[model samples]
Target chain A: MKSRKTTAWIALCASTLLAGPALAESHGMALSGDLRIISDMSNPAPRAVMEGMVADFGEMHPDLNIELTIVDREAWKTQIRNALGANPPDVVNWYAANRMLPYVNAGLFADVSDLWEEPAFEALASTKGAMTINDAQWGVPYTYYQWGIYYRKDIFDELGLSEPTTWEEEKANCQAILDSGRKCYTIGTKFLWTAGGWFDYINSRTNGYDFHMQLARGEIPWTDDRVRQTFANWRELIDMGAFIDDHQTYSWQEALPFMVNGEAASYLMGNFAVAAMRDGGLTDDQLDFYQFPKIAEVDYAEDAPTDTFHIASGAQNMDAAKEFLRFVVSTENQTKINAGDALGQLPVNANAEIGDDKFLQQGFDMLSNNASGGIMQFFDRDFPAEMASFGMEGLQEFMVFPDNLDDILARLEDARQRIYK
Target chain B: MFPTPIEKRSRAAQLSYQSLLPLALILWLLPLLAVANFSIKPESDFVNGNYWGLPSSFDLFANYGRVFFESNMPRYLLNSLLITIPTVIGAVALSAMAGFALGVYRFKGNLLIFFMFIAGNFVPFQILMVPVRDLTIDMNLYDTKTGLILFHIAFQTGFCTLFMRNFIRALPFPLIEAARVEGVAEWKIFWYVVLPLMKPALAALAVLIFTFIWNDYFWAVVLTQGPDAQPVTAGITEFNSQFRAAYHLMSAGSIVAALPPVAMFFLMQKHFIAGLTLGAVK
Candidate 1:
């Protein structure tokens, strides 16, 4: 009996050892050392999902060790800078384009051009032009979400209203919502820059695409008449009692309650807000999406920019990291990411199928139809970090004290000059 | 033959004063109450604009469990304790020794060094960010708990020394002189005589350092990146990004993160107040 037990134990140990490396090979390429992926997803939904993904990744690569640290967005940025300054992680999730430009210029991210040639990435590369920079691909595109107005469909139905197709129609709808004793819009500017999303979309719709890009690039002054006109339109809406009171004191999350309670008719937000809307007890039947409405008579193109992930140039496991990138952008994973309600992001791989999510399908269909002529990077991601900070602060000032547009624009222009110089 | 009896106040005045106490206490505790209320509220309560009102449902246990089980909060709390405890001990011990030297002995550069500590403690953290990070890296201490604790001890020593020095300066010199006259060894004098009298100061310094280090967000971010070293404050912030609009959960997490120091303060209130008021008397 003792001899039989010893033989069984030995066989068990041998089996375990044999299974480990096979598991490691399944999750793309295995790394000899530990891997760390840092993100800013500390909330329950995304955190739970990410933890599962990390576990799955670990199971598939038994030889590789994985560590995930979610820091606050602000602290994450600061920590990433400090970490890159010291020793870069094996793989990191960071922004692409100008946001990635500084880190790329600093030689902090691995150049994943070879992975871009792989069939999985090739499909994504053809679909997402923004992820490619200067003929070199930097990162994998895992999630792409559209930003627009999320309105209460139930309230619109109750009030006999329809989605507006024009700027004038949107204003009239907002006015009617207000006339019915409800706030037409709910927004918060507590961190200051959140208001910039509204400003960006509105300005893009009003002044057309190229002008907005020019403003972001500093080729056009912030104090230009076109810029002032955007604020003017916003002020007109504010004067009609269209926005929530004390908005300057509230954050985006804080203002969400108003929309969910039917106290406010609409929220201008990203696809991320879908989870919040659900958490707020607003059913699928209660929510709907609409474009920001055409502010210009000219048929200008619409552009929607998205957040992308890249490996740091100083990555210790460049080859392994690229393999991981290829795995993430693969049609299989992108479909999984899109099908999940928590993520609900549009897959950048054109050939990848998105599951039956109504809102996601709407965003995908809109993009496919080329309803938006051109895509522009989100204001914060498009401009240099410092300039973006200044612009956000300016947006807060404009919202809180609309009469200070001249001073706000002047301050923004000064900030632009300093950063550009 | 004696003192006149004191007159009683009117019933209305007494009622007003009695009413004012709870009212004032409530006013003073409004912000904390708000956080506490928000912590137990269902996400729908906030979404339905029920903020500043009674919660529709209590979810304290659920939220609290989620904070620990769903995130790295327990790990963060453990990291915080590891970083904070050693820092408190090191800073207090080092400053106590240095404070004794400066306070008991009239040495050259004593005031200069004291003033330097005072000034260094006041400089903004941003100015020190680049150089300090580089120094941490070069020391091969980057991303370690020890690296963060070491820097925090070194940085906090400035303030701790100031506090300890002044505290020791106010101690009567006759005892030290008597010990010296009796030929008590210098080390013995410091250990047996001086340390015994430093209980209040030590208690004060310990609580203060505990709070400071526990609440530290900037250094936690700068010195660490992963759960292996990051603390609760940074952890909560990271949690915020994932939940986005889940304020109830965020508030619950914030309260959980904030409770330790708050409980510490309450338990050590006397020592903390005594330490804070050390220089205020003279």
Candidate 2:
């Protein structure tokens, strides 16, 4: 099967090479020397996708020796700095938004703002804002997944509740679900980042995208009235006993059973949870999704964290690296890589067709059209790492003990002051 | 004194002891038993929170099949063997010679030289993590099987030397003297006379070091990165994907990774036990 795919790809490549002289010239110029790529897509499926892309690109330009090293995804988080600081690769995998702040400030990541100016990159405008820092683009997004409420449709149907839209309706639905002797939501704060999702959604929905980005950039203090308002709104649900009890003890996957067993009606999670939910035996009719309900009169600012690729500033093959970045974000490659059997996420290219999954369609539509406010890269990616760590601990504390709002806010305020400086 | 045997206790006490012994055993082995159970469970069982329950369906072949056929596990296991066998042979060979010299000879600073070998064992191996990694990179040995093998031998030789030296010291001094009287050269004495007497100690130390090197996770992770060099201990984590931990696959992979050391322990049970008690009794 793999040989057949390679043969077909080779035939197509030959045809394209023969048919387009302009394309051949462009490829020839960028195909010499070597392009060293270090990817963190080390899972079996994504690893295959990365290798397949490299192989195809290598085939297109036989002279370009493509060296690909796939580091384990979690380990890459720490090893990236060392890998970049020393003998750096031409291209590397990273995330979009403030997560790139350190590398950008250190001048380790090369600015790819010129690529964004090209007409081909206009297809990837949805995530352009996320890739921008200091009014220049640093990388290009390859894939992203939306964060929202994945609820037990059967439980909601049995209880005769519709998906809530406004904050009042969301509270009403939670109250109804609570009355039915089931928790309204299942969340695990043991690892603490899960609580960051709650904060991003509530905080973004309360004060719009700009204010939330300001808070993420440490421009607004954690003790601000708007930040407190976001918590006060969240406190209503906590006081109503809406979340599963003893949630602090469970990891995110551990919290899945509450919804799977019908003890909880909903989970605020990313699109990846659908696979696990289906594995736990929820059919399409039994499961559903909805954007987090509006709290105040702000535009919907969804959390769609994008995974991206950036060229090293110390790259030896800058032209090849730039061309490879273009290859990664191209409509054809984006669609193929993010297909249902591949990444199973939304492709960033606007012209690219998404996978035929129910949630993917919703997420693609939501991010491309409905999210007029802006895209958030989730809290952990949006905030500086130190502040995010301390901020998540504070968020988890607030969820458990809402009365310690002042103390948590003060601590986060201190962390923000120290971290941002 | 040790507690009285259950057989010697009163009838009621004996009955209670018999009943509680199995319970205590199960309680102690619960984590292992759970891992065993998890290895055969379908992935959905974990998702459904059926952690302690019987598997909904038997997936033993499916899970282990993926680990063996579809993953880098076989290569990792092969790396483990390549790493372990060489380290065991290298460390044992070097230490055996050092032991013979320290045990049989009266060289200058002999006690001090032995103390240096013993002191190497005292420094916590964790503290060596950074410097050892830097050393490997400096030697251009990082992420190679040779690097891991060399480090394992270097680190493990310290403990193995102490064991071999003491075991050699306990051998009769008359043996070497007898070999000398027979006009045997010194190297010949080590090979023909002393090495023959150290057979049990060699077997015991080889078994001990084999398990140590096979189960070494910390240095394996710090020194190596991918399947080309990483042993099964570090490579077992490859079962975890970016977003989800494949608990079933990981459990199966772990069982496979653990098999070599477990098999060694069982097959070399006598030597293993002797390795534990050899120096202590002396």
Candidate 3:
């Protein structure tokens, strides 16, 4: 009876050990507990690409599970702020520079410099400048997309219009298009950020690259004459009826069909819009690209600004996140992503090959030729997000009520002071 | 006879008002009608600017299928159900008990506690963000549906209690007195006598809670993360990002996400209004 009782106890102990591991497995791989990623990219193609990438990552690292949640741009900012104040995601998609600075200062992101030095990241070192703060690398660089004008080739040909090489010629071409009874520019400012593309290019053109940077850094006053000139040029375009009417009510996506259907001449957009334009049914033969017209200046460089990705400082699996970042910037993955519907994006790595898409290849050639004089980050990314918010609102007010430029400039100056302080 | 009887004119006016009712309803539902139309349209239709016109092709099923199959929409729906149903039941139950205590029993601080609940319901969620999240994290409930449900129940209990107490206070006190005189125990009086009479309140609160919780986006994002716990509203956002320019899919997804609450409202319109307007008349 003693032996039987002992045997029964031994069996119970063995079963309990077996059951614990089973329960863990049933709940699935949850290395570092639970992991989540949030981003503002909600379109299907990018989502499918990300989902596929995550699935592949899951297979390779069975002990780690990734959850991806997406929110609209407005909701994304609000949710991220709330989540950070509450329970932050393990990994998140956010902008680099001043955007990450506040979060890093708050001890929200993990430092991953050790992973940055790994062999897989050697090619990304060139782009890591944007992601680093106080000499510490905070996030991984996933995708770097370029910005340019995507024009309707068919409409340009029909109107006998060639890509303008200078700002004056670009305006003249727009005037001609308007003279011919076609909408000179098909743009939307419902979200207001769409108008910033115009401001970034014009400021980059008029003040040159370095001044644009200084402007973003708040070293220059908003009421400075050079700054006023940028708005003056924008006002000129508006007075010329270069922009579509009811722009305040239309989102970029909503205004896309007009460009696709040949009702409008051009869309000032980023490389990401290539996918959107194609999805709107424009074929390769029907699309063409050009740099935003350069203001005639001795100091200006030709390169447009860039968008970058960074690792969160608070990421639990910093090593894994770095590995993923390396994979993204690798020539193999960059080529694959560029070859897909998205175009005009240049891989940050010098050695990475351009994809088969002609527009993307041209973009690569432009990058290689150092045709880009100097890179300025996009306006929204370059400025403090809160200041950018007010700036965009100011742009809307300026657009809707053009007579209030002085008021707009004063309000912007006030916002800039508040943010910089 | 020459002046026309008052009853005859009243009858004509009533007939005219009834005839105009369907027309008014149609006018009110025009926006919804447009959305429903857009929900069924093929991608090509939207691209071709056929927004206000009849759909060139019907791809409703295809769009909805993509939303479910391509995204983790099934998981999202289940998560929403898990969070919302439990929140409704939990909030209603707790509020009912507290409301009874406050409404029937004349005790010190009764009005004070009641007013506190009323004022607390109006406080901005930002004030509660840090503490509530820290509490949930310490409880080891972060990122779980239970975490979301718990916060929702606690937060909603304020509004629900106020609603319930006011509702119960308006009830006849003679019913409770008669039950007590019949030698019924307090617990039994609540269970057998009062609860049955609270059916309308129960139904009304259930529908209101269902809609509120289902439509909640801010808390869904803050309290939950993975597909395992995120609700449909948050899921719709993820879906929107994934399919950036795919408006057809987005429209269909919106309709799918909105259906449950819409259906609940339609089925229980009378009870919903009765519950909402309970004290308004008084």
Candidate 4:
């Protein structure tokens, strides 16, 4: 069937070649690799952005002809295993941190550390840490967006409140909001990953980014004092009724109804949630975005999941893959991703042209200003798939039954040992 | 027909049946109605908290146009057709033979052979995924539409044979005997005698297999990676970004994807109706 499709394609190519001799001119192009777009990256706007970038690369390199493959993210998780186990694609779309670590360690991902030394990539130095395993950079990150607490600007104005810069102030604000008969923060744990967002913010705020990173890597035991401290803070928020009721029943999208309808004031979410909030009929003036409130006096690292690209270890076209990677992080191609109805991400290249969307600009400011400390990919991204799946479930279990924390931790720790071993 | 037609029932019973028919259909079609609702709507209707209300604007052309021109829905539809048609043909053809052997033959292990096909139906598909994928990869058929079609044919043959065997068994055995007594060859008896009478069953089984393979999402994803073999069921998800889901576009793609099977049913309406009403009339 594939051969039939190929034959049909060749037939069409032949027809086009006959109809227009100019089409045959680019047949000299030698650079080709399969650049995959997995998950939500399979979107039309994003895919168009990527296809445009690929076309742009063809114009720039003359010999570049990368075949862009967009696989549904759900299938990619399993398809990737088979695609890699046999003959890996020239370049594949994958996430940063522990997600990439296993593939890199197993020599599935080609080391592109030399690309790190390029002067054009100087601004992307912070993103490299997430893509690195054992001090060796394996991939080049292209897209990452901010994950922050999206609060009600109108509520802040009405209650004469200010954005909390510290954990105490955040708690105080939550208490004040609740005292006034409103919910403080909203989260939907139905999908479980939203629970990971709360765990991430709390862990990052309480124990600092290092501990959060360690916990994700299974380097820190789940039963550790610091891990307990993170949950303790989460428990306090639970006790304060900071999160809305029956959050376990609602997805993150479902949880937006509370905030959008004005029953809830704040929600710690990524920029993507902004699209949802607007969809729920909230105007831009009503909502304000802020970085998650500070906890202990730790360096300000945040959850910023970076979508990255890597050359396959078994790639038939290493030079083309490297060339494609270089083109991707270039200011031109990177800016194309941020252009036109595509604020779902912030381009990793600082030199890339930023779009004019205020929400996106705010995401840019929050990430850039807090860049003194590196970005950690969100929990699901920062951990291996199986471990991340278990972690999200553990977080969800905690949200549903906060008192069963110890049991959940022990179970996660057990899975951690089995998985990370 | 066995329960008796609604017209044969009492007035009050007929009234209940007539009243309940549309209600049951609507209930069954509620999810489909929602998809239809979403497909015609602009994205603003979803955001503005008016899901069940009349769409603010009818953007059917825009929505479906994007699905066809802007997105890969057409390619996916073509892929679905390529994969589904071949599988249905292969499964129905093979199962006709298998069902014949098991149903007509008085050989040893006839029940055992029929039971094997039935048992295959009971195994949960999830368990077969890994090994099936590994086997596909080993055979160098991984990521090809042929691989997906082959696996679908192989897996669906179990159900197909069960359906075919039961269907063939219900036919008159005297027809085959009469053909044999007329000095017709056994092969001719099976082909000209039995195959001609099996039209309704074939038509019924074809529609079932076509719909099953057409709507199949799991094997489409497992056996094929990209647009080369990925069918419309898995393809609609391309509108789903890791972040924001394009429900409107996905719905449009879904409607487009659902068109062929619907068209097939309509085109084969005569055969389908004839097959279903096999013993209805005295």
Candidate 5:
């Protein structure tokens, strides 16, 4: 019955959208003046997507002068504050969740709760909590990608093992892989955030999503018994020699060779790793995906780091800025921009069709149907900046020296008190 | 002699020296050779962890073609030229006048003024980064070629002035005295006599400053950004995308960015060597 209602509603939306000129007039036909946008989609493929969106949006509202500036993606992090504190552009790119907290509090991001009230935004319900702060929405997510374990199918087949579904099965599979003279997982903690991925999965699976987010919010101490349980769970695999040796020396890209060369059977990485694995000559027949298995019977809580667009609080062209954002989240625009040959990621709008790639399809299915607990914005984006830095460092040390757990937890507990204070 | 040449050593020692010299030379040049090798490799080779292995396929034309035709490298190279040429001229000209005044006039506090020029070189430029950036922003010159050129000229002038002054002091004094005795104006004595005599100093300083400004990555990053104003040194990082570093493309871009200063060195080899020692002894 719910599926039928969704189909009928989607049909209604399609009819109105297809009705053409009269509907378009109400949508955004009157937008004019210069609508400036600063995007951090500076990579070649995403750069084209941003420019294409600007061109199409300009064509739709011919009277509106749309200006687009693309900044280098990494440099934009430091420069965003300067851009927002002064004569800000109409729209700018940023991340979702706690990453937006500083700008929201500084009054740099405009409140867009009214936009969320519209029936059209229902398609983006999954990410609404991430976009909201203090009971109001600050931005809209455009794209996000899922995180999971990408394993070598041939290795699993040779060992007569299947994708693990629980903590017990996972360890048993790891032992089998070790017996076969391969590490169960390959990870690089050199830059320190890759270890945070392991923590996010283990912590979320060990104690449900609510407890994990509470920990992220610094409501719970790192010395909490529940938190130790998460570590104890992780320590099992570390103690079993389940991960590659000297992983602290490699970058995330450098860690890819282990899985590609069959020294490691799998990698617990984001969907982006599939491209690198493929570049390393791992064909689809050899590579496959599986969700991180159940622990403590908690529902699946997936990491899908979202990239968003927010209207500047000091926008000169408010109406046009809001309209352009609306245009950005429109089903057609999201579908085109996040297509396989474009940004090559999942669209935020549930109604938008996913790309035809096998990994993208599996990721979409897993996130849409299986991720009932929650969608986390990864470790770094979910936590405060200072805390995430300290947390990742501690996590890397813990991965390297499991015996240092006591000292690490105490230091983190101290950081939590200070940071959240 | 306390120490002898390689030929004066025993046979065993000479043999080791002959063999180890080529080994050391190869070791020293290995990194440069690796960069050249990487610049011609396919992008997939990096992903495949073939970093030190023979490239799976030669992609010299494709990679370099992308750097030249598809990327913003040409514009960045042009920006470097625009910034470097003006800075070299400005620094050399200002220092020539300042060097002439301090070297010839014997005015009050002339030695004090020369000491001040030498003192400016003692400052570590890294300490000036924040203040210099703020100054440019306040002057409304942030991210402009003029701002970079101005800063480069101001900062480089100190060393240039020191070099020019010492070189000018090394010149025979009677030539200037004779020019003065002919009732020629002081300015004419500078223009016709001292200036022509300072040609080698000017060439050495110009080549030195040109390379210095062209290769400056730290200030280039601090003072400017984007293709409109940034020099090739900082702009080479444009090859890194959000997730992955394009090592192949960056290697190609680095080679391209390095060519101008290298070409200047080769073309002005005499001036470069002379510039290194011109003011050191005298």
Candidate 6:
């Protein structure tokens, strides 16, 4: 009888728990984010930085209650679109530039242009181009990192080679590395975006920055003469066998072993690859950085991906959400988040000090260099999702069969017409 | 016994069968063993590319401790328990009644109702995501453990009813007839007579539901968000940070997540085996 009564009570309690309101009953402003700025789950530094910023924002508006939800990063990439639908959160963490353009067209994000009118907005002055779409500013960028050619420093020293500044000089360096019995570039194109990095460089260099950005924004056709020239430059590298053999079999991470094993001399990738290389036991002295070699008579334009946060179109607490955005882009908060477990990204705020860390310093010199035609937020972030997917698939196919360039370009043009509409 | 119990075979045949048993078990368990090995080794071993070698240092404590203490795993585990136990009880309760009604009643459309439940089990789950999500939102249950649990119970009833209806049909009919001659009411006949005989099936189905709901990752992510509603399987993904995936911690998380189902299996091993083989022999 006692056991039966216990079972009955347990069932009742279970039912009540399932039907009860969620942990916090008080309704508040909701801000959803992609979690984990670092690989370690035990690392509290990243959360401390974000929460510290949030607490300060809370203090300024005591009447408003705010709740933040940070989901896993990959899941967030898929679910952020859902956040824009019915039952929308007050604000969402997102990316800047052409990535935000389509959703802007859909009217999913609120117009924060008035936020730009506020004084002391000089912090993210350089990222203004990326943050703006259709002549109106959309979101505020908090953190972003640089992408460039991370090469074998020891090999360069041994062969007496310097950083390649032009296309011709880059070819000569590739030739030199080849003659020494090592390949120059090793990439994994199974997921396809890896090859898009090389395409971003070749296109930006061959046709200059304006045309390249226009191409990503779908203002130029895929089969345009400038696009053809970009492919021609990429084919030149492929014909010379500058990249590793059968790269389609490896992931971006898997290709790093070749660089570590000394079989490949360089990798065109993001700054995140540095920590992984260090994990593989490659010393700082062994690995070094340089911009992608210039291909045409164009100013250097680099791929520096930036992450941003925006107010949802149908948000309930608009004023509180705007206040949260204001705090996130502040020079102090940006500096704190960057200095915390988010160890890699350069703060969007110009005043945020680039610590004496050798990487941030080298990256700062390359990016802030006057020769830079300013930042392109990488291929995936700079193109609409549909067009980016089709382009990445085409890029992977081209990597495997460089001879099928015309067919690939024609197919991409067909997709572009349909997707842009 | 079926297949003449191998013991009646020649000595050589018996010896070969005994030898092959361990070999096949090892083949089946190899990947699981590798995951187990990974759960114990430090991240340095993987960094050094010592995948197949002995660990330089055992991190059995540190890895699991971090997964529990330093991560949102404890809360996630609690969320899973709250979501699953109720779902198992609710699904089994509903399915048992529906199965009994379909098996014993002479009602019209009985076959159609049973077929409808059976047909639902065959439809792909991915197709239900969008409409179901919208419905949950409309009901104000989206992003809650209650939403996930309720949806799990609804969908899982399809398979559970199929299992139960077939199991109920396989039982002897004269037992119910005997009880009816004694003027027992229909509901009493069900509660007293049929239910007492359903012990093996109930035990098997409860264990099966426990395993299914506990290991679920997709619906946990789809209908729920954050530590307040997500289960351990979804919580395991928190280790995959921005650029790099932490395989060592992920492996540790996976092992911890896999334990409840393994324990449930071992605890119900007898009833589970008996239920599976009941129809097979007859």
What docking grade does candidate 2 earn?
medium
Q: What residue runs in model 3 are displaced by over 4 Å at the alpha carbon?
A: A1-93, A97-140, A297-328, A336-346, A353-355, A400-403, B1-20, B44-49, B106-112, B115-134, B162-183, B242-246, B265-282
> What is chain B's TM-score across the candidates, in the order shown?
0.86, 0.92, 0.83, 0.91, 0.92, 0.93
lDDT of 5 by residue, A112-132 (tens): 897787667888887887898
User: Please, what are the lDDT tens digits per residue for candidate 1 over residues A1-421?
Assistant: 9645544543343233223335344343334357777765544455555676677666655666777776545556656777777667767766655667677767777777766654445456433445656677777766677778889999999989999988789889998899889999998888865687877777877787667767877788888999888888878887788888899988788889889878899988877787778877889999999867888764433335554567777766554455456556656556766666656578876666886777778777666554444555677887788999889988877777888888889899988888887
- State each candidate's chain A TM-score: 0.81, 0.93, 0.76, 0.89, 0.93, 0.85
- Residue B276 error, candidate 5, Å: 6.5
Docking class of predicted structure 1: acceptable
lDDT, residue B143, candidate 4 = 82
Better of 3 and 4 by DockQ: 4
Candidate numbers, best TM-score first, in rank order = 2, 5, 6, 4, 1, 3
DockQ of each: 0.38, 0.69, 0.19, 0.28, 0.50, 0.16
Of models 4 and 6, which has the larger DockQ? Answer: 4
lDDT of each: 0.76, 0.89, 0.73, 0.80, 0.89, 0.80
Q: After superposition, how far is residue A269 of candidate 3 from its true place, in Å?
A: 0.7
Relative to the real complex, the DockQ score for model 4 comes to 0.28
Clashes of each: 19, 0, 21, 4, 0, 0
Which sections of candidate 4 miss by over 4 Å?
A1-41, A63-71, A79-90, A341-344, B1-26, B48-62, B97-125, B165-170, B173-191, B266-270, B276-282
> For residues A1-421, could you state the per-residue lDDT of candidate 2 as single tens digits?
9656544543343334323334644465335688999999988789889998898677657788889998878779998999999999999999999999899999999998988877778878888989999999999999999999999999889989999999999999999999999999999899999999999999999999999999999999999999999999999999999999999999999899889989999999999999999999989999999999999999999999999999999999886788778778877888999998888999999888987789999989889988988899998989988899999999999999999999999999999889888
- After TM-score superposition, the amount by which residue A173's alpha carbon in candidate 3 deviates from its true location, in angstroms, is 1.8
Residue runs of model 5 more than 4 Å from their true location after superposition: A1-28, B1-13, B273-282
Worst 10 residues of 4 chain B by lDDT: B43-52
Top candidate (DockQ): 2
| lDDT measured at residue B50 in model 5 versus the true structure, 0 to 100 | 84
Measured as a fraction from 0 to 1, the native contacts recovered by model 1 come to 0.61
Write model 3 residue lDDT over A135-251, tens digit each, in one string: 988776555656678898888888888999788899899988898787878887998988887888788788876777678878899999999998898888889988888889988
